[model samples]
Structure formats: structure tokens, C-alpha cells
Target: MRKYRHLFRILYLILLLFVFVNLLLGFYGYAFTPLLWNPWLYLGAVTVFCHIWYRFYRNHAPNWQNLVSVLLSLFAMAILVFFIELFFSFDGHDLVTIHSEYYIKEKTIVFQRGSLLDAYDEYHELVNPFVMKKKIKKKVYID
Candidate 1:
């Protein structure tokens, strides 16, 4: 167990880095799939795992300085996750001209606008129209 401490630390750091990259990609709208799990849950699990691993496997005594440093790192990661989640929650809208007509010296125009809520509505319509419609309708009203 002692001999594998370095390997475990490296793997742990790699896992954290992977999560960070995923959050960054997700923020940029480039993620293949949205994160399904809660970041707080992940942080909690990591904290518990590290505590057990170091206390038992590494035969290390619990120290306040170490705990504070670990918590600070986790807090920083939590802030990053919070920003990404905030970005996903907000929606942006764009206006598009769908059609225009000129007749008898009069001009007529049509406009089409879209947003993240609209996209979600379309997707939910395809999946389960009845339930999604009610849920989305409530959301729309709230918004």
C-alpha cells in the first residue's frame, strides 16, 4: 500500500483534471453529453475516499492543515462547477427573419426567434409530449 501511494495520488489528480476539462467543454457547448451527476456529490465522495485512503492505507495522522488545504481545493473546484451550471441554466435568444414579401408598395415581414427553452420543448415533444408539455408550460409561465 505504501509503495502505491504515488500512483494513487497521480491517478487522483488525473481524475480531478478530467472533471475540470469536462466542465470547461460543457461551458463552451462542446460537450458530447451534459454531466449527469451533481458536483457536490462528487466532492463529498472524493473527500470521504481521500480521508479513508490516507488514514488507513497511508498510515497518516489526521491534521488540520491538511484538511484545510483539501477543503480549499475542493471549494475552488466547486466554484468552477457552479459557474458552468449557471451558464447552462441561462438561455440566450436570437431573432431570425423567416419570410418577407413586397406587394403593391407595401412590405410584409415575418420573424422567427429561438431559445434553449424552445429547443428543450421540441426535444420533450418528441420524447413524451403530454408530461413534457405540462412541465414545459409551467416553466414557460415562470420564465
Candidate 2:
């Protein structure tokens, strides 16, 4: 119906606004810790603000009110996963912990780089990720 279409439009606008705000925050790192600042966190803050805006339109736009919140949460979760993978990769050395979706169903982080560490590949994730990540944990990140 005409009403449902309008609801979608309203939801779209809210989503776009949140994206723009998060983009700005992503560009400006927090002062507390230079490297510690993450874009997703900044976006999360803005998303919360947008939630308040959604509350204002709740009565008339109840159907689409919480849609933005759901989407934003999903988006933030994806970003978090990416950051986690990057962190683990650098610390994981040649053995990058990868989530293989093609072959395995369960979440498996594989550390693979070269044949040198191939021998230790089995032990790649056996040890703590921090310790498991060594320059030669198996070998260099690249061959």
C-alpha cells in the first residue's frame, strides 16, 4: 500500500543519515588512543543518536522505526569481524586466521603462508593467538 512505501522511504533516509555521520567519525580518530580508535565504534555512537530520532517518529512510523536499528547493528557487527580478522592476522604471522566458508561450515581461522611453516600449520592455532603469532610462527606473512 501507499503507506508501506512511505515507511520504507523514511527508513532509508534514517539509514543514510547514520552512514554519513559514521563516515565523518571514521575519518577523525579519537584522541584518547591514536591506534585504539575504531570507525565502527564511532558509527555505533551515531547509530544510538539516530535511534532517539526514530523514537520521535514511532507512533506514525512504528513499522519502520526499528528497521534502521536492526540494520545498523548488523553493519557494526560485520565491521567488528573485519577488525578482529585484521588484528588476528597481524599477530598470527604467516598463519592468518581465516574463516573458511567455502569448504568448512564451522568458523575456522586458518594460518597459512608458506611451505616453511607448513609443518607447523597444524600447531598454528594450537597456541594462544598472541604467542601463536610469530614472524616465523610458520614464516613471513608473505612468501
TM-score against native, each model: 0.32, 0.29
Q: How large is the C-alpha RMSD of every model relative to the true structure?
A: 14.8, 13.4
Estimate, for each residue in 35-123, the C-alpha lDDT of model 2 and write its tens digit.
12234344445555455555555545555646776678767766766676455433432222332111211222234323344422322
- Candidate 1 segments whose C-alpha is farther than 4 A from its true place: 1-62, 91-123, 126-143
Q: In order, what lDDT does every prediction score?
A: 0.39, 0.40
Q: What's each prediction's clash count?
A: 0, 2
Candidate 1 lDDT, tens digit per residue, 44-141?
45655565556553555668877787678667766765664444444421111111110111121111223445532211111221111111111222
Checking candidate 2 for backbone clashes, the offending pairs are 95-111, 98-110
Cα miss at 18, model 2 (Å)?
36
